[model samples]
Target: MKIGGLIKFTLIDFPGRPAAVIFTQGCNFRCRYCHNPELVYPHLFTEPVPQEEIFSFLQRRQGTLEGVVISGGEPTLQEGLIPFTADIKKMGYAVKLDTNGARPDVLAELLDKKLLDYIAMDLKAPLDKYSLITSVDTPPEILMKSMQLIRQSGVAYEFRTTYDKEVLTDADIQALEKLTDKEHYRVQECLPVAKEKAALKVLHKEI
Candidate 1:
Protein backbone atom coordinates (compact mmCIF):
# COMPACT_ATOMS: atom_id res chain seq x y z
CA MET A 1 0.00 0.00 0.00
CA LYS A 2 2.53 2.59 -0.98
CA ILE A 3 4.31 2.22 2.35
CA GLY A 4 7.06 4.76 2.82
CA GLY A 5 8.47 3.50 6.10
CA LEU A 6 8.25 0.64 8.57
CA ILE A 7 9.27 0.23 12.16
CA LYS A 8 9.86 -3.47 12.70
CA PHE A 9 8.82 -3.33 16.35
CA THR A 10 7.62 -1.04 19.10
CA LEU A 11 6.52 -1.37 22.67
CA ILE A 12 4.33 1.73 22.95
CA ASP A 13 2.81 2.46 19.57
CA PHE A 14 -0.08 0.03 19.75
CA PRO A 15 -0.88 0.42 23.44
CA GLY A 16 -0.77 -2.72 25.59
CA ARG A 17 0.55 -4.77 22.69
CA PRO A 18 3.80 -5.38 20.89
CA ALA A 19 3.42 -4.18 17.32
CA ALA A 20 4.94 -3.16 14.01
CA VAL A 21 4.22 0.22 12.41
CA ILE A 22 3.64 0.78 8.70
CA PHE A 23 3.95 4.37 7.58
CA THR A 24 2.06 5.00 4.37
CA GLN A 25 2.95 7.80 2.00
CA GLY A 26 1.00 10.97 1.09
CA CYS A 27 -1.27 13.09 3.26
CA ASN A 28 -4.14 15.42 2.41
CA PHE A 29 -3.26 17.98 5.07
CA ARG A 30 -0.22 20.24 5.11
CA CYS A 31 0.26 21.00 8.80
CA ARG A 32 3.54 22.92 8.77
CA TYR A 33 4.78 21.18 11.92
CA CYS A 34 4.27 17.68 10.49
CA HIS A 35 7.19 15.54 11.62
CA ASN A 36 7.36 13.36 8.55
CA PRO A 37 7.63 15.93 5.83
CA GLU A 38 8.90 13.37 3.33
CA LEU A 39 5.77 11.32 3.74
CA VAL A 40 3.45 14.32 3.44
CA TYR A 41 5.23 16.31 0.74
CA PRO A 42 5.15 14.69 -2.70
CA HIS A 43 8.43 16.16 -3.84
CA LEU A 44 10.22 14.54 -0.91
CA PHE A 45 8.70 11.05 -1.01
CA THR A 46 11.20 8.21 -1.16
CA GLU A 47 10.90 4.93 -3.05
CA PRO A 48 8.06 2.97 -1.51
CA VAL A 49 8.99 -0.12 0.45
CA PRO A 50 7.76 -3.20 -1.43
CA GLN A 51 4.61 -4.66 0.07
CA GLU A 52 6.06 -8.12 -0.28
CA GLU A 53 8.97 -7.13 1.89
CA ILE A 54 6.62 -5.96 4.62
CA PHE A 55 4.59 -9.16 4.32
CA SER A 56 7.69 -11.27 4.79
CA PHE A 57 8.58 -9.38 7.94
CA LEU A 58 5.07 -9.70 9.30
CA GLN A 59 5.08 -13.36 8.52
CA ARG A 60 8.20 -13.81 10.60
CA ARG A 61 6.89 -11.70 13.44
CA GLN A 62 3.50 -13.40 13.39
CA GLY A 63 3.80 -14.87 16.84
CA THR A 64 6.03 -12.22 18.33
CA LEU A 65 3.85 -9.24 17.60
CA GLU A 66 0.30 -8.83 18.81
CA GLY A 67 -0.75 -5.97 16.55
CA VAL A 68 0.05 -3.92 13.46
CA VAL A 69 -0.35 -0.16 13.34
CA ILE A 70 -1.28 1.17 9.91
CA SER A 71 -0.22 4.79 10.23
CA GLY A 72 0.42 7.25 7.47
CA GLY A 73 0.90 10.27 5.76
CA GLU A 74 -2.82 9.41 6.10
CA PRO A 75 -3.49 5.69 5.69
CA THR A 76 -7.03 6.14 4.33
CA LEU A 77 -5.61 8.14 1.46
CA GLN A 78 -3.92 5.01 0.15
CA GLU A 79 -5.95 3.28 -2.58
CA GLY A 80 -4.96 -0.23 -1.50
CA LEU A 81 -5.68 0.27 2.20
CA ILE A 82 -8.69 -2.03 2.59
CA PRO A 83 -7.12 -5.02 0.88
CA PHE A 84 -3.81 -4.36 2.50
CA THR A 85 -5.37 -4.27 5.95
CA ALA A 86 -7.32 -7.43 5.14
CA ASP A 87 -4.06 -9.15 4.39
CA ILE A 88 -2.64 -8.08 7.74
CA LYS A 89 -5.75 -9.27 9.56
CA LYS A 90 -5.56 -12.59 7.77
CA MET A 91 -2.10 -13.06 9.17
CA GLY A 92 -3.63 -13.10 12.67
CA TYR A 93 -2.51 -9.68 13.81
CA ALA A 94 -4.85 -7.08 15.27
CA VAL A 95 -4.72 -3.78 13.36
CA LYS A 96 -4.59 -0.28 14.82
CA LEU A 97 -5.24 2.53 12.37
CA ASP A 98 -3.96 6.07 12.84
CA THR A 99 -5.71 8.68 10.78
CA ASN A 100 -6.62 12.35 10.44
CA GLY A 101 -10.35 11.53 10.28
CA ALA A 102 -10.95 13.11 6.91
CA ARG A 103 -12.37 10.03 5.20
CA PRO A 104 -15.46 8.79 6.95
CA ASP A 105 -16.58 6.54 4.08
CA VAL A 106 -13.31 4.64 4.11
CA LEU A 107 -13.36 4.38 7.90
CA ALA A 108 -16.93 3.09 7.76
CA GLU A 109 -16.05 0.44 5.20
CA LEU A 110 -13.12 -0.74 7.30
CA LEU A 111 -15.33 -0.85 10.38
CA ASP A 112 -18.00 -2.82 8.51
CA LYS A 113 -15.36 -5.36 7.57
CA LYS A 114 -14.19 -5.60 11.19
CA LEU A 115 -10.73 -4.49 10.20
CA LEU A 116 -9.63 -2.13 12.95
CA ASP A 117 -8.94 -3.07 16.54
CA TYR A 118 -7.98 0.43 17.60
CA ILE A 119 -8.05 3.88 16.07
CA ALA A 120 -6.23 7.13 16.92
CA MET A 121 -7.68 10.16 15.15
CA ASP A 122 -5.99 13.55 15.12
CA LEU A 123 -8.25 16.51 15.78
CA LYS A 124 -6.23 19.26 14.13
CA ALA A 125 -7.90 22.27 15.67
CA PRO A 126 -11.19 23.83 16.66
CA LEU A 127 -13.63 23.67 13.74
CA ASP A 128 -13.21 27.30 12.76
CA LYS A 129 -9.42 27.14 12.87
CA TYR A 130 -9.00 23.83 11.03
CA SER A 131 -8.10 25.33 7.70
CA LEU A 132 -5.61 27.66 9.39
CA ILE A 133 -3.80 24.79 11.11
CA THR A 134 -3.97 22.18 8.35
CA SER A 135 -3.13 24.69 5.65
CA VAL A 136 -5.98 23.43 3.47
CA ASP A 137 -9.66 24.08 2.97
CA THR A 138 -10.88 20.84 4.51
CA PRO A 139 -14.61 20.59 5.10
CA PRO A 140 -15.32 20.54 8.84
CA GLU A 141 -18.34 18.33 8.21
CA ILE A 142 -16.15 15.49 6.91
CA LEU A 143 -14.02 15.53 10.05
CA MET A 144 -17.08 15.65 12.26
CA LYS A 145 -18.64 12.73 10.40
CA SER A 146 -15.57 10.58 10.93
CA MET A 147 -15.49 11.45 14.62
CA GLN A 148 -19.10 10.34 14.98
CA LEU A 149 -18.43 7.13 13.11
CA ILE A 150 -15.50 6.26 15.29
CA ARG A 151 -17.49 6.92 18.41
CA GLN A 152 -20.23 4.59 17.22
CA SER A 153 -17.95 1.87 15.81
CA GLY A 154 -17.51 0.20 19.27
CA VAL A 155 -13.82 -0.25 18.66
CA ALA A 156 -11.23 0.92 21.21
CA TYR A 157 -10.14 4.41 20.14
CA GLU A 158 -8.73 7.76 21.15
CA PHE A 159 -9.11 11.31 19.85
CA ARG A 160 -5.98 13.45 20.02
CA THR A 161 -4.81 16.96 19.16
CA THR A 162 -1.18 17.87 18.57
CA TYR A 163 -0.72 21.05 20.51
CA ASP A 164 1.81 23.52 19.20
CA LYS A 165 1.68 26.54 21.45
CA GLU A 166 2.25 28.81 18.50
CA VAL A 167 -0.62 27.35 16.46
CA LEU A 168 -3.17 26.23 19.04
CA THR A 169 -3.88 28.36 22.05
CA ASP A 170 -5.56 27.40 25.33
CA ALA A 171 -8.87 28.81 24.09
CA ASP A 172 -8.58 26.82 20.88
CA ILE A 173 -7.96 23.65 22.86
CA GLN A 174 -10.98 24.29 25.10
CA ALA A 175 -13.10 24.78 22.00
CA LEU A 176 -11.74 21.58 20.49
CA GLU A 177 -12.60 19.72 23.69
CA LYS A 178 -16.23 20.82 23.40
CA LEU A 179 -16.50 18.79 20.20
CA THR A 180 -15.77 15.39 21.77
CA ASP A 181 -17.43 13.46 24.61
CA LYS A 182 -14.11 13.04 26.48
CA GLU A 183 -14.20 9.26 26.52
CA HIS A 184 -10.58 8.91 25.35
CA TYR A 185 -9.49 12.36 24.31
CA ARG A 186 -5.82 13.46 24.58
CA VAL A 187 -3.71 16.52 24.11
CA GLN A 188 -0.34 15.69 22.53
CA GLU A 189 2.56 18.06 22.20
CA CYS A 190 4.06 18.19 18.73
CA LEU A 191 7.44 16.53 18.46
CA PRO A 192 10.12 17.41 15.97
CA VAL A 193 10.81 13.78 15.16
CA ALA A 194 8.92 10.79 13.77
CA LYS A 195 8.61 8.97 17.08
CA GLU A 196 6.01 10.83 19.12
CA LYS A 197 6.17 10.48 22.87
CA ALA A 198 2.99 11.14 24.79
CA ALA A 199 3.63 13.69 27.49
CA LEU A 200 1.83 12.57 30.61
CA LYS A 201 2.36 16.03 32.02
CA VAL A 202 -0.36 17.24 29.72
CA LEU A 203 -2.71 14.29 29.92
CA HIS A 204 -6.25 15.43 30.75
CA LYS A 205 -4.96 18.82 31.80
CA GLU A 206 -7.27 21.69 31.08
CA ILE A 207 -5.67 23.59 28.21
Candidate 2:
Protein backbone atom coordinates (compact mmCIF):
# COMPACT_ATOMS: atom_id res chain seq x y z
CA MET A 1 0.00 0.00 0.00
CA LYS A 2 1.32 3.46 -0.91
CA ILE A 3 0.25 5.03 2.35
CA GLY A 4 0.27 8.80 2.43
CA GLY A 5 -0.36 9.05 6.15
CA LEU A 6 -2.43 7.72 9.04
CA ILE A 7 -4.54 8.85 11.95
CA LYS A 8 -3.47 6.78 14.95
CA PHE A 9 -7.10 6.58 16.05
CA THR A 10 -10.48 8.10 15.45
CA LEU A 11 -14.00 7.83 16.83
CA ILE A 12 -15.85 9.19 13.82
CA ASP A 13 -14.56 7.26 10.82
CA PHE A 14 -15.77 3.71 11.14
CA PRO A 15 -19.41 3.59 12.11
CA GLY A 16 -19.98 2.46 15.68
CA ARG A 17 -16.39 1.34 16.09
CA PRO A 18 -13.19 2.95 17.29
CA ALA A 19 -10.62 2.68 14.53
CA ALA A 20 -7.35 3.81 12.96
CA VAL A 21 -7.35 5.36 9.48
CA ILE A 22 -4.84 4.74 6.70
CA PHE A 23 -4.83 7.35 3.94
CA THR A 24 -3.48 6.09 0.64
CA GLN A 25 -1.62 8.17 -1.93
CA GLY A 26 -3.10 9.29 -5.28
CA CYS A 27 -6.72 9.96 -6.27
CA ASN A 28 -8.56 9.70 -9.55
CA PHE A 29 -10.74 12.73 -8.86
CA ARG A 30 -9.71 16.35 -8.18
CA CYS A 31 -12.79 17.71 -6.48
CA ARG A 32 -12.69 21.49 -6.03
CA TYR A 33 -13.36 21.20 -2.30
CA CYS A 34 -10.81 18.50 -1.54
CA HIS A 35 -9.19 18.89 1.88
CA ASN A 36 -6.30 16.46 1.51
CA PRO A 37 -4.55 17.91 -1.52
CA GLU A 38 -1.23 16.52 -0.37
CA LEU A 39 -2.54 13.00 -0.81
CA VAL A 40 -3.92 13.73 -4.27
CA TYR A 41 -1.30 15.73 -6.11
CA PRO A 42 1.86 13.95 -7.28
CA HIS A 43 3.84 17.11 -6.57
CA LEU A 44 2.67 16.99 -2.96
CA PHE A 45 3.27 13.28 -2.31
CA THR A 46 5.35 12.42 0.73
CA GLU A 47 7.42 9.40 1.66
CA PRO A 48 5.01 6.61 2.54
CA VAL A 49 4.79 5.37 6.08
CA PRO A 50 6.54 2.00 5.89
CA GLN A 51 4.12 -0.93 5.65
CA GLU A 52 5.89 -2.61 8.56
CA GLU A 53 5.50 0.49 10.70
CA ILE A 54 1.76 0.53 10.05
CA PHE A 55 1.26 -3.14 10.86
CA SER A 56 3.36 -2.93 14.01
CA PHE A 57 1.08 -0.21 15.27
CA LEU A 58 -2.00 -2.21 14.37
CA GLN A 59 -0.56 -5.29 16.02
CA ARG A 60 -0.15 -3.33 19.25
CA ARG A 61 -3.61 -1.84 19.04
CA GLN A 62 -5.20 -5.14 18.06
CA GLY A 63 -7.25 -5.62 21.18
CA THR A 64 -8.13 -1.97 21.72
CA LEU A 65 -9.24 -1.00 18.24
CA GLU A 66 -12.35 -2.60 16.86
CA GLY A 67 -11.83 -1.69 13.21
CA VAL A 68 -9.53 -0.09 10.63
CA VAL A 69 -10.59 2.30 7.93
CA ILE A 70 -8.75 2.36 4.60
CA SER A 71 -9.42 5.85 3.27
CA GLY A 72 -7.88 7.70 0.32
CA GLY A 73 -6.42 9.38 -2.12
CA GLU A 74 -8.61 6.51 -3.21
CA PRO A 75 -7.78 3.21 -1.52
CA THR A 76 -8.63 1.08 -4.57
CA LEU A 77 -5.82 2.77 -6.50
CA GLN A 78 -3.21 0.85 -4.52
CA GLU A 79 -1.84 -2.28 -6.16
CA GLY A 80 -1.14 -3.67 -2.69
CA LEU A 81 -4.66 -3.11 -1.38
CA ILE A 82 -6.00 -6.68 -1.38
CA PRO A 83 -3.09 -8.16 0.55
CA PHE A 84 -2.92 -5.09 2.75
CA THR A 85 -6.56 -5.55 3.68
CA ALA A 86 -6.13 -9.32 4.04
CA ASP A 87 -3.32 -8.68 6.51
CA ILE A 88 -5.61 -6.48 8.55
CA LYS A 89 -8.34 -9.10 8.44
CA LYS A 90 -5.76 -11.59 9.78
CA MET A 91 -5.32 -9.35 12.81
CA GLY A 92 -9.01 -9.95 13.57
CA TYR A 93 -9.80 -6.30 13.06
CA ALA A 94 -12.91 -5.42 11.08
CA VAL A 95 -12.07 -3.36 7.97
CA LYS A 96 -13.90 -0.46 6.40
CA LEU A 97 -13.08 1.13 3.03
CA ASP A 98 -13.75 4.68 1.93
CA THR A 99 -13.65 5.05 -1.83
CA ASN A 100 -14.89 7.01 -4.83
CA GLY A 101 -16.29 3.85 -6.44
CA ALA A 102 -14.17 4.14 -9.57
CA ARG A 103 -12.83 0.58 -9.38
CA PRO A 104 -15.64 -1.92 -9.09
CA ASP A 105 -13.25 -4.74 -9.98
CA VAL A 106 -11.16 -4.17 -6.89
CA LEU A 107 -14.16 -3.62 -4.64
CA ALA A 108 -15.67 -6.86 -5.93
CA GLU A 109 -12.55 -8.81 -5.06
CA LEU A 110 -12.50 -7.42 -1.53
CA LEU A 111 -16.17 -8.23 -1.03
CA ASP A 112 -15.74 -11.74 -2.40
CA LYS A 113 -12.97 -12.27 0.15
CA LYS A 114 -15.02 -10.71 2.99
CA LEU A 115 -12.19 -8.26 3.61
CA LEU A 116 -14.42 -5.30 4.29
CA ASP A 117 -16.94 -4.87 7.08
CA TYR A 118 -18.17 -1.47 5.96
CA ILE A 119 -18.01 0.78 2.90
CA ALA A 120 -18.40 4.52 2.52
CA MET A 121 -18.45 5.69 -1.08
CA ASP A 122 -18.57 9.35 -2.05
CA LEU A 123 -21.26 10.23 -4.52
CA LYS A 124 -19.79 13.34 -6.10
CA ALA A 125 -22.78 14.32 -8.18
CA PRO A 126 -25.80 13.04 -10.01
CA LEU A 127 -24.70 10.77 -12.82
CA ASP A 128 -24.84 13.47 -15.49
CA LYS A 129 -22.94 16.06 -13.46
CA TYR A 130 -20.04 13.98 -12.12
CA SER A 131 -17.49 15.71 -14.33
CA LEU A 132 -18.56 19.12 -13.04
CA ILE A 133 -18.03 18.06 -9.40
CA THR A 134 -15.01 15.79 -9.78
CA SER A 135 -13.28 17.75 -12.55
CA VAL A 136 -12.72 14.62 -14.61
CA ASP A 137 -14.51 12.97 -17.47
CA THR A 138 -15.94 10.21 -15.26
CA PRO A 139 -18.20 7.87 -17.10
CA PRO A 140 -21.66 7.76 -15.48
CA GLU A 141 -21.88 4.07 -16.28
CA ILE A 142 -18.64 3.36 -14.43
CA LEU A 143 -19.98 5.06 -11.34
CA MET A 144 -23.25 3.17 -11.69
CA LYS A 145 -21.44 -0.15 -11.89
CA SER A 146 -19.66 0.55 -8.61
CA MET A 147 -22.88 1.53 -6.90
CA GLN A 148 -24.45 -1.67 -8.07
CA LEU A 149 -21.59 -3.74 -6.69
CA ILE A 150 -21.66 -1.97 -3.33
CA ARG A 151 -25.41 -2.35 -2.96
CA GLN A 152 -25.47 -6.02 -3.91
CA SER A 153 -22.40 -7.09 -1.97
CA GLY A 154 -24.51 -7.39 1.21
CA VAL A 155 -21.87 -5.33 3.02
CA ALA A 156 -22.92 -2.64 5.49
CA TYR A 157 -22.46 0.64 3.57
CA GLU A 158 -23.44 4.22 3.00
CA PHE A 159 -23.40 6.51 -0.03
CA ARG A 160 -22.39 10.02 1.01
CA THR A 161 -21.92 13.37 -0.71
CA THR A 162 -20.00 16.40 0.45
CA TYR A 163 -22.35 19.32 0.89
CA ASP A 164 -21.03 22.62 -0.38
CA LYS A 165 -24.13 24.44 -1.50
CA GLU A 166 -22.11 26.55 -3.88
CA VAL A 167 -20.79 23.46 -5.57
CA LEU A 168 -23.82 21.16 -5.23
CA THR A 169 -27.32 22.49 -5.41
CA ASP A 170 -30.41 21.20 -3.63
CA ALA A 171 -31.69 20.01 -6.96
CA ASP A 172 -28.50 18.15 -7.62
CA ILE A 173 -28.65 16.56 -4.19
CA GLN A 174 -32.20 15.46 -4.77
CA ALA A 175 -31.17 13.97 -8.05
CA LEU A 176 -28.40 12.09 -6.27
CA GLU A 177 -30.88 10.93 -3.64
CA LYS A 178 -32.92 9.39 -6.40
CA LEU A 179 -29.96 7.17 -7.17
CA THR A 180 -29.78 5.40 -3.80
CA ASP A 181 -31.81 4.16 -0.89
CA LYS A 182 -32.20 7.09 1.51
CA GLU A 183 -31.61 4.71 4.42
CA HIS A 184 -28.02 4.35 3.26
CA TYR A 185 -27.33 7.91 2.09
CA ARG A 186 -25.75 10.83 3.90
CA VAL A 187 -24.23 14.29 3.40
CA GLN A 188 -21.10 15.83 4.90
CA GLU A 189 -19.95 19.42 4.89
CA CYS A 190 -16.81 20.01 2.87
CA LEU A 191 -13.94 21.62 4.74
CA PRO A 192 -11.35 24.06 3.48
CA VAL A 193 -7.94 22.89 2.29
CA ALA A 194 -6.18 21.88 5.49
CA LYS A 195 -2.49 22.01 6.32
CA GLU A 196 -3.04 19.11 8.71
CA LYS A 197 -4.97 15.97 7.72
CA ALA A 198 -5.96 14.82 11.18
CA ALA A 199 -9.65 14.34 12.07
CA LEU A 200 -10.91 15.11 8.58
CA LYS A 201 -13.12 12.08 8.62
CA VAL A 202 -16.23 13.45 10.24
CA LEU A 203 -19.33 11.31 10.76
CA HIS A 204 -21.85 11.66 8.00
CA LYS A 205 -25.18 13.47 8.54
CA GLU A 206 -28.46 12.35 7.06
CA ILE A 207 -29.31 14.02 3.75
Candidate 3:
Protein backbone atom coordinates (compact mmCIF):
# COMPACT_ATOMS: atom_id res chain seq x y z
CA MET A 1 0.00 0.00 0.00
CA LYS A 2 2.80 2.41 -0.84
CA ILE A 3 0.12 4.98 -1.61
CA GLY A 4 1.48 7.92 -3.59
CA GLY A 5 -1.80 9.68 -4.17
CA LEU A 6 -5.46 9.44 -3.27
CA ILE A 7 -8.63 10.80 -4.74
CA LYS A 8 -10.88 11.17 -1.68
CA PHE A 9 -13.81 10.23 -3.87
CA THR A 10 -14.68 9.55 -7.49
CA LEU A 11 -17.95 8.82 -9.27
CA ILE A 12 -16.64 7.47 -12.57
CA ASP A 13 -13.73 5.23 -11.52
CA PHE A 14 -15.77 2.18 -10.62
CA PRO A 15 -18.54 1.33 -13.03
CA GLY A 16 -21.96 2.35 -11.69
CA ARG A 17 -20.56 2.90 -8.22
CA PRO A 18 -19.06 5.85 -6.40
CA ALA A 19 -15.67 4.98 -4.97
CA ALA A 20 -12.41 6.33 -3.66
CA VAL A 21 -9.33 6.07 -5.91
CA ILE A 22 -6.10 4.86 -4.37
CA PHE A 23 -3.10 5.63 -6.61
CA THR A 24 -0.03 3.55 -5.94
CA GLN A 25 3.29 4.96 -7.04
CA GLY A 26 5.75 3.45 -9.59
CA CYS A 27 4.78 1.82 -12.84
CA ASN A 28 6.72 -0.86 -14.68
CA PHE A 29 6.03 0.60 -18.10
CA ARG A 30 6.62 4.07 -19.41
CA CYS A 31 4.21 5.08 -22.13
CA ARG A 32 5.12 8.48 -23.53
CA TYR A 33 1.47 9.53 -23.81
CA CYS A 34 0.86 8.64 -20.19
CA HIS A 35 -0.99 11.45 -18.50
CA ASN A 36 -0.04 10.33 -15.02
CA PRO A 37 3.70 10.44 -15.67
CA GLU A 38 4.29 11.30 -12.05
CA LEU A 39 2.93 7.98 -10.95
CA VAL A 40 4.95 6.02 -13.49
CA TYR A 41 8.45 7.44 -13.04
CA PRO A 42 9.85 7.50 -9.52
CA HIS A 43 11.90 10.57 -10.46
CA LEU A 44 8.55 12.32 -10.73
CA PHE A 45 7.07 10.68 -7.62
CA THR A 46 5.52 12.86 -4.97
CA GLU A 47 5.33 12.63 -1.21
CA PRO A 48 3.83 9.38 0.02
CA VAL A 49 0.33 9.63 1.43
CA PRO A 50 0.00 7.94 4.80
CA GLN A 51 -1.99 4.70 4.67
CA GLU A 52 -3.72 5.57 7.94
CA GLU A 53 -4.99 8.84 6.52
CA ILE A 54 -6.38 7.04 3.50
CA PHE A 55 -8.14 4.45 5.65
CA SER A 56 -9.52 7.10 7.98
CA PHE A 57 -11.00 8.94 5.02
CA LEU A 58 -12.51 5.75 3.71
CA GLN A 59 -13.86 5.09 7.19
CA ARG A 60 -15.70 8.39 7.11
CA ARG A 61 -17.02 7.80 3.62
CA GLN A 62 -17.90 4.19 4.29
CA GLY A 63 -21.62 4.60 3.96
CA THR A 64 -21.41 7.03 1.07
CA LEU A 65 -18.84 5.31 -1.08
CA GLU A 66 -19.78 2.05 -2.67
CA GLY A 67 -16.29 0.79 -3.60
CA VAL A 68 -12.60 1.52 -4.00
CA VAL A 69 -10.43 1.54 -7.12
CA ILE A 70 -6.84 0.37 -6.75
CA SER A 71 -4.93 1.96 -9.59
CA GLY A 72 -1.21 2.58 -10.05
CA GLY A 73 2.01 2.94 -10.83
CA GLU A 74 0.64 -0.61 -11.09
CA PRO A 75 -1.21 -1.60 -7.94
CA THR A 76 -0.04 -5.16 -8.30
CA LEU A 77 3.56 -3.93 -7.99
CA GLN A 78 2.98 -3.05 -4.37
CA GLU A 79 3.76 -5.89 -1.96
CA GLY A 80 1.13 -4.61 0.47
CA LEU A 81 -1.66 -4.57 -2.13
CA ILE A 82 -3.37 -7.86 -1.28
CA PRO A 83 -3.66 -7.25 2.45
CA PHE A 84 -4.66 -3.65 1.85
CA THR A 85 -7.39 -4.74 -0.53
CA ALA A 86 -8.54 -7.31 2.03
CA ASP A 87 -8.84 -4.49 4.55
CA ILE A 88 -11.08 -2.56 2.19
CA LYS A 89 -13.18 -5.67 1.56
CA LYS A 90 -13.53 -6.01 5.33
CA MET A 91 -15.09 -2.57 5.33
CA GLY A 92 -17.77 -3.98 3.04
CA TYR A 93 -16.53 -1.94 0.11
CA ALA A 94 -16.24 -3.52 -3.27
CA VAL A 95 -12.82 -3.30 -4.98
CA LYS A 96 -11.97 -2.66 -8.60
CA LEU A 97 -8.42 -3.02 -9.92
CA ASP A 98 -6.96 -1.24 -12.92
CA THR A 99 -3.91 -3.07 -14.14
CA ASN A 100 -1.66 -3.73 -17.12
CA GLY A 101 -2.10 -7.52 -16.69
CA ALA A 102 1.56 -8.16 -16.05
CA ARG A 103 1.09 -10.14 -12.84
CA PRO A 104 -1.49 -12.84 -13.28
CA ASP A 105 -0.56 -14.48 -9.99
CA VAL A 106 -1.48 -11.47 -7.89
CA LEU A 107 -4.64 -10.91 -9.88
CA ALA A 108 -5.60 -14.55 -9.46
CA GLU A 109 -4.97 -14.50 -5.73
CA LEU A 110 -7.10 -11.41 -5.31
CA LEU A 111 -9.85 -12.93 -7.41
CA ASP A 112 -9.73 -16.20 -5.47
CA LYS A 113 -10.13 -14.28 -2.23
CA LYS A 114 -13.01 -12.20 -3.62
CA LEU A 115 -10.94 -9.11 -3.05
CA LEU A 116 -11.65 -7.62 -6.46
CA ASP A 117 -15.11 -6.96 -7.73
CA TYR A 118 -14.08 -5.84 -11.20
CA ILE A 119 -10.97 -5.45 -13.31
CA ALA A 120 -10.00 -3.28 -16.25
CA MET A 121 -6.80 -4.52 -17.81
CA ASP A 122 -5.03 -2.37 -20.35
CA LEU A 123 -3.91 -4.02 -23.55
CA LYS A 124 -0.85 -1.98 -24.43
CA ALA A 125 -0.68 -3.26 -27.97
CA PRO A 126 -1.69 -6.08 -30.25
CA LEU A 127 0.72 -8.56 -28.67
CA ASP A 128 3.55 -7.99 -31.15
CA LYS A 129 3.63 -4.24 -30.67
CA TYR A 130 3.52 -4.04 -26.89
CA SER A 131 7.10 -2.95 -26.51
CA LEU A 132 6.55 -0.06 -28.92
CA ILE A 133 3.65 1.31 -26.92
CA THR A 134 4.77 0.62 -23.38
CA SER A 135 8.41 1.60 -23.86
CA VAL A 136 9.41 -1.54 -22.00
CA ASP A 137 10.65 -5.01 -22.74
CA THR A 138 7.44 -6.98 -22.24
CA PRO A 139 7.02 -10.53 -23.28
CA PRO A 140 3.72 -10.97 -25.11
CA GLU A 141 3.34 -14.38 -23.48
CA ILE A 142 3.30 -12.91 -19.97
CA LEU A 143 0.41 -10.59 -20.79
CA MET A 144 -1.42 -13.35 -22.59
CA LYS A 145 -1.24 -15.50 -19.48
CA SER A 146 -2.87 -12.70 -17.53
CA MET A 147 -5.57 -12.33 -20.14
CA GLN A 148 -6.25 -16.04 -19.97
CA LEU A 149 -6.55 -15.87 -16.19
CA ILE A 150 -8.94 -12.95 -16.45
CA ARG A 151 -11.14 -14.76 -18.95
CA GLN A 152 -11.28 -17.91 -16.84
CA SER A 153 -11.82 -16.13 -13.53
CA GLY A 154 -15.54 -15.54 -14.25
CA VAL A 155 -15.21 -12.03 -12.90
CA ALA A 156 -16.54 -8.94 -14.64
CA TYR A 157 -13.76 -7.46 -16.76
CA GLU A 158 -12.96 -5.52 -19.92
CA PHE A 159 -9.78 -5.34 -22.01
CA ARG A 160 -9.00 -1.89 -23.32
CA THR A 161 -6.43 -0.16 -25.57
CA THR A 162 -5.55 3.48 -25.71
CA TYR A 163 -5.21 4.73 -29.27
CA ASP A 164 -2.33 7.01 -30.07
CA LYS A 165 -0.46 7.86 -33.30
CA GLU A 166 2.76 6.10 -32.39
CA VAL A 167 0.89 2.98 -31.32
CA LEU A 168 -2.37 2.22 -33.04
CA THR A 169 -3.96 2.79 -36.42
CA ASP A 170 -7.03 1.71 -38.39
CA ALA A 171 -5.15 -1.33 -39.62
CA ASP A 172 -3.94 -2.13 -36.11
CA ILE A 173 -7.47 -2.00 -34.77
CA GLN A 174 -8.51 -4.56 -37.35
CA ALA A 175 -5.42 -6.58 -36.54
CA LEU A 176 -6.30 -6.51 -32.87
CA GLU A 177 -9.60 -8.21 -33.61
CA LYS A 178 -7.64 -11.32 -34.48
CA LEU A 179 -5.69 -11.08 -31.20
CA THR A 180 -8.67 -11.21 -28.85
CA ASP A 181 -12.41 -11.70 -28.85
CA LYS A 182 -14.31 -8.54 -29.71
CA GLU A 183 -16.82 -9.13 -26.93
CA HIS A 184 -14.19 -8.20 -24.32
CA TYR A 185 -12.56 -5.32 -26.16
CA ARG A 186 -12.75 -1.54 -26.13
CA VAL A 187 -10.81 1.18 -27.97
CA GLN A 188 -10.27 4.43 -26.12
CA GLU A 189 -9.34 7.62 -27.90
CA CYS A 190 -6.04 8.87 -26.56
CA LEU A 191 -6.29 12.18 -24.77
CA PRO A 192 -2.73 13.38 -24.84
CA VAL A 193 -0.93 16.06 -22.89
CA ALA A 194 2.00 18.48 -23.40
CA LYS A 195 4.29 17.20 -26.17
CA GLU A 196 2.25 14.10 -26.64
CA LYS A 197 -0.89 16.13 -27.21
CA ALA A 198 0.82 18.15 -29.89
CA ALA A 199 1.98 14.99 -31.57
CA LEU A 200 -1.49 13.51 -31.56
CA LYS A 201 -3.06 16.69 -32.92
CA VAL A 202 -0.67 16.53 -35.82
CA LEU A 203 -1.62 12.93 -36.38
CA HIS A 204 -5.31 13.80 -36.22
CA LYS A 205 -4.94 16.56 -38.76
CA GLU A 206 -3.09 14.21 -41.08
CA ILE A 207 -5.92 11.72 -40.76
Candidate order by TM-score, highest to lowest?
2, 1, 3
Query: What is candidate 2's TM-score against the reference?
Result: 0.93
Q: In model 2, where do residues sit more than 4 Å from their true spots?
A: 195-207
Q: Write the per-residue lDDT of candidate 3 for residues 1-207, one digit (tens) a residue.
A: 677677666788788899988878888898767867767777877677788988888899989999999997799999989899999999999999999998888998998898888899998777878888888888888898888888888888888888886668888887776667788788888874776545423422331
Clashing residue pairs in candidate 3, if any? Answer: none
lDDT of 3: 0.82
lDDT by residue for model 1 (1-207), tens:
788788877898998999988889899999867877767888977778899988999999988999999997999999999999999999999999999999999999999999999999999999888887789988888999999999999999999999988878999888878888566888988886535412211211211
For residues 1-207, could you state the per-residue lDDT of candidate 2 as single tens digits?
888778877899999999998889999999888888778999988777799988999999988999999998999999999999999999999999999999999999999999999999999988877887789998877889899999998999999999877767999888889889899999887765563344333411100
**TM per prediction:** 0.91, 0.93, 0.90
Model 1 C-alpha lDDT versus the unseen true structure = 0.87
Ranking of predictions according to lDDT: 2, 1, 3
Q: Candidate 1, 46: how far from true, in Å?
A: 1.0
After superposing candidate 3 on the true structure, give the runs of residues whose Cα lies further than 4 Å from its correct spot: 195-207
Best-matching candidate per TM-score: 2
